[model samples]
Target: MTAMAAEIKKGRKFDQVLDGAREVFMRDGFEGASVDEIARVAGVSKATLYSYFPDKRLLFSEVARLECNRQAEEAMAEFDLSDPVAVVLHEAANRIVRFFLSDFGQQVYRICVAESYRFPELGQRFYASGPALVRERMSAILQPYIDRGELVIEDMDLAADQFGQLCKSDLFVRRLCGISKETSEAEIKRVVTGVVEMFLARYGA
Candidate 1:
């Protein structure tokens, strides 16, 4: 095979390993998951799995990192900077709640919660790759509103964090505790609207 074909094959193998890692990690938490099982699931030999990821820790970290980035990207994609503040907040809340309810999102949270004590670095990895990024993105959006005197806030960072916490409280807790059901649209809208109204009342122009 040509060099290009070899690279393509390598890429495909990496994807296969990631897919298998996600499955194993979700089914058996990061601490309980094993590289042998992941390789078996991926239909690859242990050596092949190692070729893609040097160890189980690395593989699990990459899987969680990728999923977190994907969730953040999905949430960011739905945001419309030109929309009204209320509309923007509501849409952001919906996206956040939806992300927490996703399978990968819930599993990532489980891994963080379960393994944080044993592998404290995993917690930091999750926070840096996920919530930290979310907060940063949210702050960027809110900063414009604050600068334009549309929203009055002592701290845009705090406001963004509170907004995300409010939107995620219920779904995130439930999902972390093993509840797989999605939040109802009506519930999400009601909560988001209430939060947005309160925020606007406190900070609106």
Candidate 2:
């Protein structure tokens, strides 16, 4: 386990602390957020907060990990793995696009990019919780389809990663660069449809 992970101890107020931290981090970002504000928001004493999280960075990383996992799990729970490959791929594409454009998702991406140079572990944790986790779950969803000969994928990891990249298309950069404030449903469907079509063209059996 990471030193940060080792230091974090869960308690009855763990979620409460996380919730407050998330709000502060989202509003003020990692550097601007203060421990005092977080404790005040959580309604916990500074001492209580320090017991659960010895460092502010630890608290921030934990919040990011939990939120990313929660979003990914919620998406997976709604997926019908038995559906046709096209249907499942489309669902995955839509979920990926929506998530990449979300406020929290964008913030996490920014934080990882900004802090990874100084704190390599921050980026590692983000990858483990976000892209790596998604790839594993997506690979599981696609494996049965590949076995049934609906998709011809020699490398499950590469194919899953490609599908994820396809979902990004131009929109991800547009949002990241602040060219677009909100992605409409119609825009999302356009990207999703293209991703599914492109992926199936390359892999369909």
Candidate with best TM-score: 2
Q: For model 1, how big is the CA root-mean-square deviation?
A: 6.7
Q: In each prediction, how many residue pairs overlap at the backbone (N, C-alpha, C within less than 3 A)?
A: 0, 0
**Model 1, runs deviating above 4 Å:** 1-16, 23-37, 40-43, 51-57, 178-182
Please give the CA lDDT of all the candidate structures.
Answer: 0.74, 0.86
Q: What is the TM-score of each candidate against the true structure?
A: 0.76, 0.89
Q: For candidate 1, write residues 40-95 as lDDT tens digits.
A: 99889898887666646557767878877776677678777777888887777777
Question: Top model by lDDT, which number?
Answer: 2
TM-score of 1: 0.76
Question: Candidate 1: global Cα-lDDT?
Answer: 0.74
- lDDT of each residue in 23-114, candidate 2, tens digit only: 99888877789999999999999999998988787688889889888877888899887888899888888888888888777888888888
Error of 1 at 169 (Å): 3.0
Ten consecutive residues with minimal summed lDDT in candidate 1?
Answer: 1-10
